[model samples]
Target: MPWSPALKSTLRSGLHLERTVTEPFQVLRGMLGVAIVLFGALALGETGLATSAALGAFIAGTASYQRSFRPRPVLALYAAAGLSASSFVGYLASPWPPLYVVVLGLWAFTAGLAWALGQTAGVVASTTVSVMLIVVTLPENVPEALEHAGVIALGGVVQATLAAIWPGRRWGARRDALADAYASLAHYARRLRHDPFASFDPDPLMNARRAAELTPAQARRRPSELAGMRSYAERIRPVLAAMADPRVGAAEEGPQRDRARELMGAAAEILDAIARSIRSGRPAPIAERTYRALTVPGSGPVLDGAGRQAALRLIGLLAEASDAVEAVDRGDPVHGEANAPGHLSRPGLRQLLPVLPHALRRHWNWSSPVLRHAVRVGVVAAVGEILGRSLPFQHGYWAPMTAVMVMRPDFSQTYARGVARLAGTVLGVVVATGIIRLTHPSAWICAGLAVVSIGGAYLLMRTGYAAMSTCITGYVVFLLAMGGEANTSTVEDRVLLTLLGGLLALIAYAVFPTWQTVRLPDRLAAYVEAGGRYSAAAVDAYAEPTEHSRALLRAALLEHRQTRAELLTASEQAAGEPVRHRGLHTAQLADARSAMAALGRTTMLMEAHLPPPQSSPVPGAAEFAEVLREQTAAAARAIRADEPVDLHALRDHYEQWAQWLPTPAADPADEPGGAADLVYRDAGLLVEALEGLDSALNS
Candidate 1:
């Protein structure tokens, strides 16, 4: 295949139109919000009010994809507050030139600070910024501002009501998510059966996990179903990977291999059936044949202890997956484990006050990317605003708005997005003009098109910002036409202003840049630290059995998983970034990734071997747990400080735990019946896993 510049760009940015629609319901829900606003505003036949309402719709609509575990009413209230606040700020500042620039700049800064919260918050903040740009330009008088405010408020209320009424296929999202989870397992199983050495991509599994994560507890098919689905998904990946171990594969290639392969094939079929059932929104009976296959005794190859253990783990995971599906179908609580409680609760006015100082301190420091980006945005937005007002371009808000949207925290992202933004705007303008000239649509048609474009914009948001920008530009064109003010000249102005704004954004980022390549090590260190804490928690849970200890283990595990996911995502971003004047050592980065993967496998095995809380643990278990904690902490510190980790010391220290393992001649009757045996087995597994992780890191 010949490589073109466009192809290179697409590959570098991971762009593909197929991903434009992540969730069909999210797009439809947002479109419904816009449609409602358009319907209400068009019925009134007031252009000014319609314009204000349309802006409000777009603001609220863009946030339709923000998912939370919170109740609908709570989330709606939060959305309404954000809409009202952005509208008010924009309206209050437009009359005075200096105040307009200063306030808009400050708003940009505050929106930038929203990145501290997470991706969803960042999306909401960006939408609010765009809303401010539109609302502030709607006349200057006090009466006009008040009227616009009223209309905007009405629009927001309409959106909130619509969201509550039709929240877009709740069951569909859960169904798709659960199906995807099963499909991923099936795919992995097939691959392992084909070739033991073949690697699997984690993205599909991660996406499945993300889908389940966003699903609200009440919205799920069964109690704790989403959580159970995610847990099973996590456990299955490592177990499959373990089953693919070359030693296990090489040990039995005749009858034993055939039997193992047959079971895997059956498991895959069962998973596919479950996925199909979920997709069809029906409860399908578990296949009796598949269950029997798992239940049948091992009649094949003799195996070493390690191979036997791997085979046992694979069967156990398959059974676990089967149980999860049955539990979902029965509408029973899956796994019987309580889902983790909310990490960050919805904040009230009083709650905000206590955390204001801490939030400020956390986000206003030099080490904070959000703080640095906020300052960059503030300065550049002020310049863009001044330029927009100085230039005699009509609808001058485009320049400042474009600048606000294009500028990102890092230089690479900002520059790449700026290029894409400029290109997309030009293309969108041309396309919109052509459509208008050919169709000559009426106001109602224009209104409908505007809503459709808004939906497309959000649908493509994740694939690439440039694609989203193209849809948004068309949305703006149609929206203006709905207000009876679009023309060929309008397209020209939009294209020119967008280019200018994009250029400004690129220059601004160049002037004050934050490079991800430099920050990757720190992020990797954070992942290491989180992993260590999680390992300690897992070990401690065994040392003492209590509800509190279990909760801590869950929390630690969740935190570490999140951090590891973050590291993986950041690695991709850094890898794709244009490498000019950067310290992105490819070899080192690969090592980091490999180490993380190894650590993940170890964590999975540890979780699998985790024992129920015991009345008393082995005396040496505490010492082994300490070894893991100290070793992992040391590795994190070494990575952060750019020092080489000494795996020899870690290995030497962990060797003492080898005594806990059962000897070849040992019998089960010789050990304590329950707690002591469980403790010994868990401790041994944890120690060995830690050693494997340590070796991977050192390598």
Candidate 2:
């Protein structure tokens, strides 16, 4: 955790270029919008207006590439509106240097706080800050400023229009998300065949759930193949785990275990087939051997109890998948239930207006990283502007603009981005300036070159921030050249200004840091609380088998998955911090993570054997479930308070519940495979997991 090592790590991360799956058609489509705005402005003989409109279109196009489930056109429009408003206000205040500085600080602060909404919103809002700085220097009067703002807004309109009319693949992102979930299941199944207790990553399922959210109109027009499929994928996961687990399904090594392995292998193939079909929007071509393996024969080795149940459930799920694929091929309206547990409802753009204030208010606290980041951005931006103006640079606004664009809430990102931005600016300025001096291209040729640079930027957006920044620098250089600003001094000014801006941003974060290490305990407590809810919900379902209980269990499971993901992400980010905290040593954190995983896996095993509707309720389960929830909630609080995590009450309640239940029959044939028996057996494992957690925390 030394500063030297941490800095080296962050720099490597910054310079690393990722190999992403590039969609050429989509990149070209986004570029078309920029080309239209630029060329149209050039035809009208307004170079200044052309630059403003192209900048707007380029930023809006970049917003569409962000990882969001919302419609691309809507994102474009939102970015456009922010850009237009920021540009107008910047021009209005440019006459008074003091007033403009205040406005710039306030605007940067608001843009930073926009992270409360999401990363997409934050990035788009930050672009508005840059636009305000860049475009304010162009307009000479009120009428011309209005004209520039209108043209910039028009650029967004063009991008939105193109997105709506020329969507490359309808429902493509959603299809890929769902496909990835099934693909993950296939990989899990394969892994389980070799390692019975393998852990599954829930990220693909989470992405699929997000993709499933739709506006009312989208929901109505959704494809039949997409309906009810995600629910099937979700249900298949726990069952797969149940079958492979030695405790719940087959013994360690026997005929039953071999049969379980075969079934799992077959299931993996079927899942892969379904994934391929879903991704391609074609009929699933299942293999004959896979079907034969799943089909029950009269004389094959018998899978009793939980193993038997899991096999039957998996077969039914596979049938449902096959039928859905056939329905897609036949072009039939398969009226299967589309509602899944923990499904989210996304409101339309207009509906988001009323809730925007509430969303912003939620992050208006000292503890919130977003608020701290906003303050840092505001102060740094104002200081950067002041320093830039004090210097002898021709375009002083470049310095503040760079600071606003590169700054993030965390240390790693702010430093990494600062490094990348500086390096990229140097590379871009050298290459672009060299080209202009060598070719001495006309204004029209410079405009064309700017268009090409924008296209390269769009294409390399996912590669790395550094590569994209290089392209962006070239694009800006060419655009400015078209306005007759391409002199030898331009390169020196741009590179030095960018370096100054990046250093200011980095220094501000170092002074006012928001370390993820400090928040680790809170994130761990959240995971513990969510795990408790999941365990309680699973237990409660045994006490009363109803649709309501099922829904609660599903919701709890989703919450637990989300919390686990958050904890893991926080841990990764915290790893690179220069400061080392005192609480929770490395071993203790690992033990805590292992204990939580064990707890969730045990609860999932119980969930796999949930009773059917109208089944008799298990005795004493309701009281035990209540006790489990209360003890876990209290333990979470203790963890957050740095107190011992005592779970004696939960363990005591479980012991009493076990005593109240009737003893299992000695003969294996006489043993019941009902919900009551399964609940009794799994509750002991749940208590053990809780005890493990208690020990990990108290240690």
Candidate 3:
């Protein structure tokens, strides 16, 4: 009944189509690539070439579906080259079952390792594996392997050309991302008005920020800008919660309470205006008004000491938010100094060579999900290939390919993909058979249908994985028919072998599964450790402002981001695991996610308030900074040991800081010495959030 269940429900509801089909451009891009490849093959009077070419084009198109700062042509070239290499290997070993099985296993291992790199690389690698599985069945002499590979490469070129033609709506995507972030802030604002302790749903905004991160670093809507927006939103949450405390606001009809409510109302309106401006490519209409309201004379009405502190903090945060929104008005980066870090760095050849050993040492392990996946997929595929050869399977590749496709790293998705593949295969075989029987189309018509089927498959890919599978299954059947293998026997064998492969995948996973939830503790601990370092860097920067401190802060932030990504992935994989196999229940996972989000927001706030070079720094800043850093490290240790964090000293520190500004002070908000006091108050909010997390963990 608590917020955790509601949070879990919100996440799971995305299994429906709304979250799946984010944009129509992806489908369009994929369809154009397949159409060009198939039409070209037809024009050349070689229906047989359609199979390899279409496969190559489709895979390449899929790889470049999400536009990035990396040139479309470059990404397309890599995808094409990989596909061509896979085709050559598959064709060369087609006749020798023993050799083919060995090559397939090696390919699986290398391709599986790609997953450790990132999502885009993983997609390209998996599609290459798929290309190999399909092309191996093409009846061609060993010498023609290179020629087939070349044709596949040509298909990749065609896709690249299409990608260049329609480079996507870049600004529109940015607007949508920024809009989502502002809208999330608006949602939190409304909630704070009623329940300060309301659960914060960070997924929508974080996902939007990630989507923006996929764009080029030099893009107008940069990752740093999105990050700044997220920080502003996060900074306000705890402050508003603090303000909402009954002790902070006077009884009914009090001046301070009225002022607080007015400030919240104006802030919510400004957030909404910012969201609209993002969507409409216009300036935030209320930015000036909001700034005035927040900084106006007597903004902090007479209130208790804690109430004044909360009010002052809120005013400072609102002022920062106004500046950010104004920058958005001019389409400028939120933080000019902070470069938006890429999801993965592109190192030079020499740099990469030296780092390979470290990379291998980090990722190559029995406990790693990617390594286990490589082993599982390779072993199962080899066994499947052997059995397919021994049995009277018409298309031996289909069996092993099915197993490869269905066997994911997580148990739930592995089982789900198996079921989806089976259902799709059966439906496709029926549909293809009926069409062949009723129309009896010529080779040209069959080729056209194959192209159409491929197009439709990609169009529906994001809508539902099963729907995409259904279309792909039909396309393959029709494609083989075009290549002169349209016999009823071939059709029957395809259906039977596909079923066997799916069953094999299920059995293999049942025997030895890779459960992400099992490693959640280690992943969470690593995240906490990274977060602690980031916090330490930030506090250290405050105490001793220097270029070196700033660099350390950036490096620590990058580390934390990477760790956070891993934790998010683990949480998702855990969600997909079966209940019996899950390491933590739904509520626990939600709690962990909430804690991590709070920490991330707090870190961003620290970055926002990082002090510039100070001639004479406040003496107390050093002591306070050390205390903050120590608390952060203590938090990491507590999480790793699954113990409640000791926060009694932190509470006392907050009380001492609150004593700096009392009620009825002369010019409390405008005092020149208020900078340190405001920072102390903000730190108190962060400490409170940490205490909330400690309580959640204990509960």
Listed per model in order, the count of residue pairs whose N, CA or C atoms clash below 3 Å is 0, 0, 1
Candidate 1 residue spans exceeding 4 A from truth: 1-16, 19-32, 66-77, 194-257, 285-288, 298-361, 431-452, 455-467, 481-491, 536-553, 579-584, 656-699
Candidate 3, 583: how far from true, in Å? 9.2
Candidate 1: minimum summed lDDT over ten consecutive residues — where?
336-345
**lDDT for each candidate structure:** 0.65, 0.86, 0.67
Ranking by TM-score: 2, 1, 3
RMSD of model 1 against the true structure: 5.1
Evaluate model 3: give its lDDT: 0.67
Per-residue CA lDDT of candidate 2, range 178-281, in tens? Answer: 89999999999999998988888999999999998876567766777677788889889989998889877877798888999989999999899889888888
TM-score of each: 0.82, 0.97, 0.79
Q: Candidate 1 residues 515-588, lDDT tens each?
A: 56567877787887787778777667667656777778777866776787777767765654554223335666
lDDT for model 1, please: 0.65
lDDT ranking, best first: 2, 3, 1
Query: Which candidate has the highest lDDT of all?
Result: 2
Residue pairs clashing in model 3 are 69-216
TM-score of 3: 0.79
Q: Residue 686 of model 1: what lDDT? A: 47
Worst 10 residues of 3 by lDDT: 336-345
